[model samples]
Target: MLYIIQTTLTLGFVYSLVALALFISYRILDIADLTTDGCYVLGMAVSVTAAYYGHPIFGIFLAIIAGMAAGYCTAFLQTRMGVPSILAGIVTNTGLYTINLMVMGWSSNVALLKKETIFMLFKHLGIGGPWMDLAIVAVIVIGCMALLRYFLSTRLGLSIRATGDNKDMVAASSINPRFTITVGLVIANALTGLCGALVGQLQKSADINAGTGIVVIGLACLIIGETVMNGKKNMTRNILACLIGNIIYRFIYAIILQTRLIPIDFLKLVTALIVALAIASPSLKENFSLYARRRKESL
Candidate 1:
């Protein structure tokens, strides 16, 4: 029981980073950037490759740089080349497959053999006991939430938010919507990359197919967070929702895995159902309210 709780908590924090990315791109910028799946593998490929080469810490920074570059590619296609936002993400994601393969030395998988990971280093810090891994992930996630909150409150962040709300309005005000959009996408992908980097280091391995359907998972997590707070627009509430939602999702998922109620093969399908239900919840509630009101009137 303790092991299950710790595992769930650790992964919950690790994956919340991807939820943060979707929050910015989907909720904030209102863009469906499909680059998420490939970009995640890209970060993992870079980080694990670097760790394989004996530079575990430097690998994380490199992964961020790589993620930023991937974001720039998508942004370039959208802003300069006149590609549609969704298509731009698809193109970038498609291109990342080859790039990721190259980064992994043309291999489909990579692992750290007798190598150190960021988690191992944190464990050695003498601050965390048996839960050192969970502690490290918790600190990183909390710090990210803090930085993201602070960033969203700044002038540039406001511009980015405004661009999401009304790009034309921002442009009319001479705020340069193009620049803001580019910056927003760049930052969002950076978070995704950081997530992949940390996940790779934690697991000490990277696989080409590991990131499949990751965007859906991230969106699911974000929507779960939004639903928890009743769709409130307060920045603090929304951010906390990100943390709370992931933990809740992980807890439920852990329970399912522990109980063997569903086969491992069907977990993804169940996850999709959960996401669909969460997405439709608002409409469902409104329908129920109307039905109850009609019954009351008849009575």
Candidate 2:
């Protein structure tokens, strides 16, 4: 049970970065960038490849740079080539598969053979003792959350936010909506890359198909986060929501799986159901509140 709890917390922190990425792209930018899955794999491929070469620490930086490059490609196709946002992401993602394979030496997966991961390095420092993994990932997640909040408060970040809210108004205000969109996607995918890098190092392996359905899962986490928290009007609350939602989701899934409430084969079905309920939660809450008010009026 302790092991399960630790695993749940570690993964919740690792996966929340994806939710954070979606918070920027889907929520702030209003762009459905489908490049998420491929970019995730690209990050993993880059990180593991670097780690295999005995540069575990440098690998993370490379993964983030690779993710930024992927984002630039998608942005180029969308802004410069006049491609639709969704199609641009699809084209970039399809191309990333080949790039990922090349990075993995044309292999489907790569594993670290007794490499010194950041987790091990930190553990050697005798900090957090038995909870080293949890400690490292938790710190990274908190750092990212804080950085994202600060970034969103900056001038350029405001431009990106405005671009999402009203591209026309932003353009009229002398802000290049295209530029803001490009920067926004770049940052969002960078977070995705960081998440991928951390997960790869933690697991000591990377797979070509590891990012499959990641966008859906991220979306589920994002929607779930928004539903779980009230007054998400502030940047801080919304940012925290990503962490809170993933933790809650991980807890629910782990408990159900551990207790045999759901078969392993039906895990995907359960995820879909959770996502649906989360999507409808706001409406349900509103209706319930309305009903309560009407009942009081009648009384």
Model 1, 115-148: lDDT tens per residue? 9888788666676777988888889889988999
Give one digit per residue, the lDDT tens place, for model 2 in 1-299: 89989999999999999999988988999999999999999998899889999888899999999999999998889988999999999999999999999999999999998888778886776778778899889998899999888989899988889888886798687889779989999988998998899999889999999998788788887877877786358889899888888888889889888788888778777787777777788799999999999999999
- Number of the predicted model whose lDDT against the real structure is largest: 2
For each candidate in the order shown, give its overall lDDT on alpha carbons.
0.88, 0.89
Candidate with maximal TM-score: 1
The per-residue C-alpha lDDT of model 1 at residue 288 equals: 99
Looking at candidate 2, what is the lDDT of residue 40? Answer: 93
Candidate 1 local distance difference test against the native? 0.88
Model 2 has a clash total of 0
Model 1: ten consecutive residues of lowest lDDT: 121-130
